[model samples]
Target: MHIPDGLLSMPMIIITYAITIMGIVYSLRKLKNFPEDKIPLLGLFAAGVFAAQMVNFPIIGGVSGHLLGATLVAILLGPYAAILVMTAVLIIQTLLFGDGGITAMGANILNMGIVGASLGYATYSKLKDMNEVIAIGFASWLSVVVGATLTAIEIGLSKSLPFMKVLTLMIGYHVIIGIGEAILTLFIIKAVKTKLPEIGGVPA
Candidate 1:
């Protein structure tokens, strides 16, 4: 889902950069207000997310998929912190590993960090009270779908590809990927609740 440079048009790139900058700035302010003791946990979660993204599995038609870990991080560290964490991960991947494009960094951050984490967090928060497992699962799945949809739209708007074709292809493969995300998220949440107990106040 990491768009390479030259994939997005100038206008889309600028728009994404503007939105991403605002999200980063707001998240930094919110981070300053977070409890000091929880700072290390943020690092831990970031590291975990970074590591998880290292392994990409083949999907279909020669495409591949990897864990975004956006929803998972949001579940553990709220949307603001999750944004910061994802930003760091993406920067490292782009600059150090060349996984994502340097020019398209802002767009990637906007799609995965802002859209994925924020919407996923909101979804989980609203549904958790009803059923924790279901909430995490649903949020994890829905977040990926939403991100893919946005990516498709961006590509479509560029006039480089057919709108519905790109949309269908992206969403079709990601639907399976979303199931993996949901399962991984649920397992991790369950593990944290059983072992850490203090993290995220996961219900017993």
Candidate 2:
């Protein structure tokens, strides 16, 4: 969920910026030598993430919510790249779309980019010994739900917006919507690994 400007306090905003900076630095280091062949794929994935996020699925009675697609990016490009892509999405939303506030950009990045990427990738790696596909699926699903849940908590904890309802709403919708994330991530990972043969050595 995008926390519009003036919703978060100063301290929270500052902390989020700090986290965003760390994430960006980490991503740049990891992507220092990104392969040229993946350029188109990267663009496609970014565009797909943007488009997918635009389509809100019905969550509550009359309310709907959108996805961050963080797990999808992590599954495809690894966690670091996923963070960078998510940051790009947040920037776009802030500058052009006005969907999220500029002050809360850092918070959004930390929520959707860092937390989502780190959780999804770390979970996948931890579960890798069992089954890659299942690991990815589970990790992707949990990452989105967890990411959104944490973000909602962050908002609720804020002095400016200490509303528990946000936590309930965000976590509620994201839990089910996360299934879509998990499935899509698994399917794409399987498809790419089967056809590409070199990406992450995933077996068809």
Candidate 3:
């Protein structure tokens, strides 16, 4: 979900920016040991996510939800790299497409990049040994829901909208969109595992 400008209060904006900046710094540090060869794959994932986010469907207020692809990227790359990749995508969208607002960019990155990647990666890693398909599907779905939830909380806390109403509506819409995310993630992961099995060591 992309939050536009003028929706969040000044305090919330500053807080989110502070948190997001810390996350970015930490992720960059982790990338210090990242495989240099994976750079292309990272770029590929970032580009794909950037393109996918182009098609957005409006939700209540100035928010809109779309195929985030954060979970999928997290699965292919590590969580740290996934965060960076999502950061790149979000920054590009904010600067080039204005898909998300400049002032609200921090919140967008916090919700979709940090939360989405970390949650998805944790969910998938825990369940993968049990059932790969289920893990991917559930992780993909959960990422979207959790990110939307965070967005709801941020917006609601800003007092721009009633906390319960926005939370309910955001969760409801994201639940449906998350299914699409799950299916797309499953399809892509499966295809990559079949065709380019060596790409990410994605389990078959």
Q: Output the number of the TM-score-best candidate.
A: 1
Clashes, model 1: 0
lDDT of 2 by residue, 55-105 (tens): 887754786666677766776777777887888888898899997899999
Q: Residue 148 CA error for candidate 1 (Å)? A: 0.6
TM-score of each: 0.94, 0.86, 0.92
Worst 10 residues of 2 by lDDT: 195-204
**lDDT for each of the candidates?**
0.85, 0.77, 0.86
List residue ranges in candidate 1 displaced over 4 A: 60-62, 202-204
Of 2 and 3, which scores higher on lDDT? 3
Give the top-scoring candidate (lDDT).
3
Query: Local error of candidate 2 at 37, Å?
Result: 2.8
lDDT of 2 at 92: 90
Q: How far is candidate 3 from the true structure (C-alpha RMSD, Å)?
A: 3.0
Deviation in angstroms for 20 in model 2? 0.8
1 versus 3: better lDDT goes to:
3
lDDT of 1 at 145: 91
Which portions of model 2 show Cα errors greater than 4 Å? 160-165, 191-204
List of clashing residue pairs for candidate 3: none
